[model samples]
Target chain A: MSALFGRSRSVLSRLVGALVVVLGVVTLTFFLARVVSPDPTNLYVSPQADQATRDQVRAMMGLDKPVLEQYVTYLGQLVRGDLGTSFSTGQPVRDDLLSRLPATLELATYSLIIGTLVGVVVGIVGAVRRGGILDHTGRFVTVAGLALPQFFVGLMLLWIFFVVLGIAPGPVGRLPVGLVDPPQTTGFVVIDALLSGQWAVAGAALQQLALPLITLAFAIFAPIARTVRTAMLEALDADYVRTATAMGLPQRTIHYRYALKNVLLPVLTMLAGVIGFAFSGAVLVEGVFAWPGIGQYALDAIQQSDFAAIQGFVLYAAVLYVVVYLLLDLLYARVDPRVRL
Target chain B: MSVALAEGNLLDVVDYRGGFRGPDGEVTEVLAGVSFGLRRSTLTAVVGETGSGKSLTALSVLGVQPRGFVRTGGRMLFDGEDLFAGGPRSFERVRGNRISLVFQDARAALNPVFTVGHQLIDVCRAHRRLGRKEAEQVVLDMLERVRIPDPLRRMRQYPHEFSGGMAQRVMLAMALVSEPELLVLDEPTTGLDVTIQADIMDLLVELISSSGLTACLITHDLGVVAQTCQDVVVMRSGTVREIATCEELFTAPRDEYTRDLLAASRLVEAR
Candidate 1:
């Protein structure tokens, strides 16, 4: 009974911690949005407007109220899932942000999948070979990836593949402008294309997505490879590895079955970090490709000083980061016996 | 009398030389011209202080030496087959099927994620073609053969769940599952308590005899050699200092190193 109670207490503690973080982020973001240099009401009003027009615009935007009162109103609206109207688009900020989020999620997911597979395989091979030529070559590639910044890589890829080679699809958008209809299931163009059985549309979407994904993946690949290689090397030296070898198990079996299982936690932790980094890094890649993702939206918001849009974007990214990290922690606890719940 | 005199040769080592690379990539010799041979169906103990190349010699025979260490010269023959002639692939076929090694620490030796039964089954599956049920039965039988109380319960338990002695027994079971011609015990009883050490040694001795398997037991304890091994090889500073029958070495030693080791054992026994 006491053990059960102890478990319940830990669960409660985790919930409380998550709640405090969310509350703090929301409050800080609300205050920061209110304190920006330009008055938000002026962004919507004409310069030659009369005094009555100016006062009406200020009152309409709630800019006439004190900062604390405005903050309280924002918090109450946020609790109700109302992100308010955007001054620039005259659309609901929540709808605009939500609509853009899925595209970024799709891009991030694809980039993560490609990065993890490529990184883990190379890392394992490098570690297994240690000082051999394969190990040396893998290290060189990883170092190159680590040193090259994301935007530079993206620009170079565009120049080489799209301009010089002229083999890849042109950098217009995620899918061909009007040639294909979006799929209904997930609204992610790639998934929708695949689900609709339109191989050409799927192929075109993939081709369009390939350059940005590679750019994002290159930024993540180096760190993931380094982490996995270190973890694999440590696992290779473990006693169980020696024991497995002593048992006459094949080298591949020993490496994949015994060593890989133990090192998965470290690799997964690195993967979680990469996922978070990729979300932020996607901003540059998306802008370079002209992909309509939340990252590009965020960039536009920064340029226009769209305070509500910026706050919503930041909040969305924070929630994404927190959710992914939480899921990873749960996964790690399941895979490793040493981790307490 | 030496068991070497009683039975024909099972394992022979001659002129072994192995070492790791220094920081500057120069060869730093760990084993220098060490040589010994063991008779069939008997335990031969290699006694040495720490870093005396005892474990290195055993690893060389198994063809699983540490990285960066080169075996510059050696001929290790088991049942008249040269171990060094074959590459890693060929060595894999002979290792664990013809010869198996038990590491010094059993707790670290066994895979923590797997049950003892699973490890045993894996050994069987690696060397032979057996169905899952048959393999499991073999594991249970191995557990019983090692004198583990309640073999069923013990087989299901992981390495960490077992006591030190029990873990050692599981390791022995793993090593002997294929009934290899030779078993290398690298300080098998070093980390156990006094009482547990005695029990494990007795268990090993009984298993070796009943299975008619040869053993090369490596330890620094002369007393353990006197009790369990028929022949003894004394090593110091990466060189073999003496080799003799257990009784003869204990009673009439030649080298001062052997004599010093016996004297140390006597001091411990007296205490």
Candidate 2:
């Protein structure tokens, strides 16, 4: 029973830690966004307008207040569940981000799954073979995959898979232009479409999602595979693994069950960080693909100097990253008995 | 010392040659030639310094050498059957069932991610078809046999939580759980304290003697060989310099390397 309490305590502390991260990101972004070159109101009231017009626009946007007072007001608004308004869209930042969130989450989930599956198999083969051809291939891919940015990979996929062979759908939103969308019940059009029995819409959305998912998956694969391979190699050489081998356990059991289990803790740690970073940091890929996700929303907001939207984006990303780490910490503490005590 | 087999031998390893393959695909010989035998009820010690390939010889017996360390020329006969006849498949059935090894660095030899029970249970079931309850019972029984107090509670504890001596005992229990006829222990007391080392050697001797089991101990400590083994093989630089009964080798060393080792042992004991 006490152990149960301890686990809950750990979970509670993790949530508290996440809140602190939110506070830090909110404070930092609030201050930093203020200093970036373009004045947000210049996009609104004319830049060449008189000082009186500029002051009027600033007052209306709550920017004319002292910095601290604005921050206090921002916290108050956030507590009341308002994320302020996007200057460019004239829509509430919260609603805009929420609508685009499902798309980003779905894309990130598929990419993370793909990356993990590909990385683990490749890592195991590399570690088991050591100096064999698979090991060398994994090493080369890890180096090249990490160095090549996601947008470049995205464009390459677009050319090869779409332009060259016309195999994939074009750089469209979640669905092709003429296809009808399923009813938006859950904000995730794919799941919502499946729920409402619109298989065609779900299928079309998935087809459009393929290239971006591949790009983001490739982006996240390098770090995970590299970490797994290094950790697996070390584990394969561990004394316990040798002991297990001496026990005459089947080679498969020794490598996968024993060696792989030991390698998992470190790999999971790196994987959690990679997925968190990739989920919120796929902004460039989003641009190249024109996917209707928060990455695209964030990019447009940053270009137009939309102060409120940028702060919201930073808060969301920080929260997502923090939550990912917290879950991973709980998992590590559970799986690795060394840390549990 | 090689087992002086009057009637028959349980294991015979003859002119075993092993090496590591470098990136250039050349073999760097680690074990030039290692030959030894184990009879029904004898404790033998292979004493050597670091890089002398004592551990490699032991690993080769269990067919657990690293990928690069290949046996270029050798033969291992266990109970009249050539162990090398099946190319690892023959030992696959014998290892952990008929022969088992307790490695150096017991702490590193046990996985840190699991409780003692988790590992012991798996090992128990690895060779025998036992249910979870039956396997767990075997774990507790083996821990008790190793003289570990509070076997039930210790089962839940991780390797890092145990002392070096305690961890080595746990490993001993793991090796003995499967009831292998021949046990190979590789420097089991290397990192332990002097007092703990004596206690561990005593326990090992007591267990092996009570069961009349054959064991091969690989170590650099002459004191350990004297206290725990009946026979001793003095190895230097991957070659056996002297193989004699424990009493004979220490009193009348045949090799200069053995004489130096004896002198070093006496100096340490005197201090």
Among these predictions, the greatest lDDT belongs to: 2
For each candidate, what is the lDDT? 0.83, 0.85
Backbone clash count, each prediction separately: 0, 2
Candidate 2 residues A146-263, lDDT tens each?
9998889999999999999998999987899998878877766788889999899999888898999888888788888888889998998888888877876678877888888889
Model 2 bad stretches (over 4 Å): A1-13, A37-39, A131-144, B1-7, B23-25, B267-271
DockQ for each model: 0.56, 0.72
User: What tens-digit string does per-residue lDDT give for candidate 1 at B156-249?
Assistant: 7778888888899889989988879999998999889999999999999998888888999999887788788998888888889988888888
A97-121: candidate 1 lDDT, tens digit per residue: 8778777878888888888888998
Give all TM-scores, in the order shown: 0.90, 0.93
For candidate 2, what is the lDDT?
0.85
The residue pairs that clash in candidate 2, if any, are B1-B232, B1-B233
After TM-score superposition, the amount by which residue B157's alpha carbon in candidate 1 deviates from its true location, in angstroms, is: 4.1
